[model samples]
Target: MKKESRQKESLGRILKYMKKYWLFLGLSIALAVISVILTLYIPILTGDAIDYIVDKGKVDFTYITPILKKMVVVILITAAAQWIMNVCNNKMTYNIVRDIRKDAIRKIEILPLKYLDAHSYGEIVSRVIADVDQFADGLLMGFTQLFTGVVTIIGTLGFMLSVNVKITAVVVFLTPLSFVVAGFIAKKTFSMFKLQSETRGEQTALIDEMIGNQKIVQAFSHEDEALESFDEINERLEKYSLRALFFSSITNPSTRFINALVYAGVGVFGAVSAIHGGISVGQLSCFLSYANQYTKPFNEISGVVTELQNALACAARVFELIDEEAQVPDAEDAVVLEEVKGDVDLEHVYFSYEPGQKLIEDFNLHVNPGERVAIVGPTGCGKTTLINLLMRFYDVNSGTIRVSGVPVKDMTRSSLRSSYGMVLQETWLKEGTIRENICMGKPDATDEEMMEAAKASHAHNFIKRLPKGYDTVIAEDGGNLSQGQKQLLCIARVMLCLPPMLILDEATSSIDTRTEMKIQEAFGRMMKGRTSFIVAHRLSTIEEADIILVMKDGHIIEQGNHEELLQKNGFYAALYNSQFAQS
Candidate 1:
């Protein structure tokens, strides 16, 4: 019972995509109407042929040839009209589907980091590609076939009834029988298609996961386990696909049997009436032709419904993504910032990802214009959380965050983000040359400026040693470079932009001693005349910071300059001792 309700809901959702292309849809229906009405003329002409010869006992090549030629003309015109309508429908539907797919992607792309965190990577990927594809393609083909089929069926039946009520009765009786058989087929087929859709999403995700984490899988000796998981998803997809095929196979044969029964029944009834001389040979001939022609629309429809259903299922998944509310939205009339001086204020900011369990409580901090500060903490200490809130990844539940005395929310997000230069611990790079990745940080960077940024970041030497210098192609995720080289390139990339504020969140923590000296020299050159936040393990980097913050469990445990914090001697002292001991 619930299943049937869900099926209707799925269809309604699928129909929603067609609203935009409804004008072309109307043209398709109008064409179907013309075609159906014209089809009835052929059967009527069959009656006329018999009447002109057998009933009147007269034959003339002159009249018969013209009548037959006219039928051919009508057939050709109607066929041409239907073809044109179908072609327009196809073109319009494809555009609508493409636009719908693009919008769904746009929605997914702008979604907040938290939303991505909530869903599996595989599930999100499937929803974007396979599911969206199905929705658009299904909407086009299903509506086109179903709507045209109905028009032909209704028109054919009306003309059949107008000619002889008894013959119309004979044909209409098969309607319920055809529907019942088609209903059984539809139910079985829908279930298989649904299973197939789900299986395909899982398979796509599984393959992506295995390939993405091949290193870990191999290290853990999980190759056989991974293969087994993939095989399981593949097997399920094949199983459901075969079931849909089996049910669909039965539809044509069932419709054929019902059609045969109707024909035979009409023949037997018409023969009895003619034997009594109650019905003429012309009327019988026309009535028989009408019966055959009437079933034309039904045959076309029943065959396409199975296919249409599968497409509808795919569309259902797609619209679901489109309808989802984005995690963030800017005000309609928000304004962009102009010439930010990087004065930041975090005032009594209380926040949590989950309700009633606060990760940050009454957190307050203020940095004057062009002031450089270093923030340090243990893992899960809200060090990154402070940066995240500053970035507006999540909004504070209470209090306010301001940039240059302007509320972050009031300023347009794009303008607000453009004010900062951030370099993180994990320096993620694309598959590109040294200049390409550097250029990405500032697209308008001049050649001299680009090289200067590289020189300051200490990435110039290694780049020059490579085969093509700055033009060398780095492998995926910068695999061709050493860890230190990758970090240096990322720093150069960030330095290329030279925004008013800079953030280095453990950016040089993973490098060896030699690279560390080079990175420190680069950092010195990059830090001039800008407010920067340095999240680092190397205490020397923080020694020159105007203010130092020690964060733990979402609160600032201690705050001072490097010398003042050392004199206090608590968590900061222990960390300092450990660092020197390791050295």
Candidate 2:
């Protein structure tokens, strides 16, 4: 019962998408009716022409000629109608698929960060691209085959009954057998097809992960392990796909066999009736044609039933993604900060990615405008999590973080994020030219402004050496650029914005020591009159900060200037000494 309900819901949603194209749908249906009615009329004309031939030489050419001519015209009109109907179906199907993809992408943009973090990128792509394509194929088949098949069946049955009641009864009586066989197979195949779709998604995700990180897999000598994992997923996909195809394949042949029986029944009974002088030879001929036409649709409809099951399964997966809960909206009267002074304060803050994990508890901090504060923490010390909270990517579990004397939660996320310039360790660049990437934070930046920002980040020298300089197009994720060059471009991006507040989370980790010193000097000039939060692993880079924060296990264990912390010989002193000892 639950499965039936879900199928109905999936179909209902699909119909809603089609509702906007009602004009095209109506035209297609009207064309199907005209095509089927005229196609059925052709056999009657043929039967009439046959009646005019009593004996081959004695046939009346004058009477049969007009009927033959009429048959030709009817065939031409029927073919034209069918062609137009198909054009309508194609237009409607593609437009519906376009709308579905648009909705899926828009939903992804508004989805919460937590949801994206939990799902694989490959799985999401599969839902939006692969599943939508499957749905379009199924819908197109339903439009072309299903509608015409149904109309043909109904038209032929009516014409058959008009010709002779007894023969028509035989066709009707045996028709239910075809339906019974098809229904049983269809019911059994839906579950199998559904399983096949899920397995395909898993396989796509596994392949995406392996291919995207092929360098890492080979570097670690895990090629065999990667292949083994892929094989496991591939085997599961094969099992489910074969099972689905097997059941669906039976529907067409099984119905064809039953249809053959019905045709034979009509031929036997009509022959007996004709010999007894109950009906003319011409009438018998018409009945046989009607019987053939009637049973042909059963074969087509059986095939359509199988395809529809697969389509519904893929549609269900896409609908599930579209129905996911979006992120909570901002308050109705959210404030928009325009001129931030960079005064940030956090008091009694509590947060954890998961409940009961107890990562950050009662955290407190205060920094006035233009303070250069550096944070040094071991791995898994909530350094990045703090950045996420301040950016409002994830709200705190409890507490208030204020920027420029306004609670971060009270301000719109757009305005809050735009007030700060951030550069992270993991660099991301879209597929575009170097100038486009540098100007991402400020799209309307002038050429002089863009070049100045790049020079300050020490990326101008490298940019000029490229074949096209700033006009050179970078590959996806900046794959064409070296690691240090990519990092410089990212830094140049933040420099272009030059917001009132800055967050540098290991911003120079990939640069050489010489470039690092030059970039550090640039950073010193950038940080002179702005509030900066620097999260660093190297203790030497942050010795000149106004205040140094040493964190361990999500708590701020030590806080002071460099000399003050070293003289105290606390956790900060020990950490500072350990780094130099290793060097």
**Candidate that scores best on TM-score:** 2
lDDT, candidate 2, 27-121, per-residue tens? 99999999999999998998998899999689999999999899999999999999999999999999999999999999898798999999888
Write candidate 1's Cα lDDT for 1-583 as tens digits: 8656767876776457667778887888888778777877887876777677843556866778888998999999889977987886787778777787788889887787778777678877887787767665665666567777787678777877777788789889877788888877887877788778888888888888898789899999999999999898888888988887888788888887887888888888898878898678888888788777667556666777777778766766666777788866888877688888788999999988889877999999999877778998888888887888887878888989999898998888878778888888877888877788988868888999999988887788888999999999988778769877888888888888888888889888767777787777777767777888888777877888888998888999899998888899888877877788767
RMSD of each: 3.8, 1.6
Model 2 misplacement above 4 A: none
What does candidate 2 score on TM?
Answer: 0.97
lDDT of each: 0.81, 0.92
For the record, the alpha-carbon RMSD of candidate 1 to the native fold, in angstroms, is 3.8
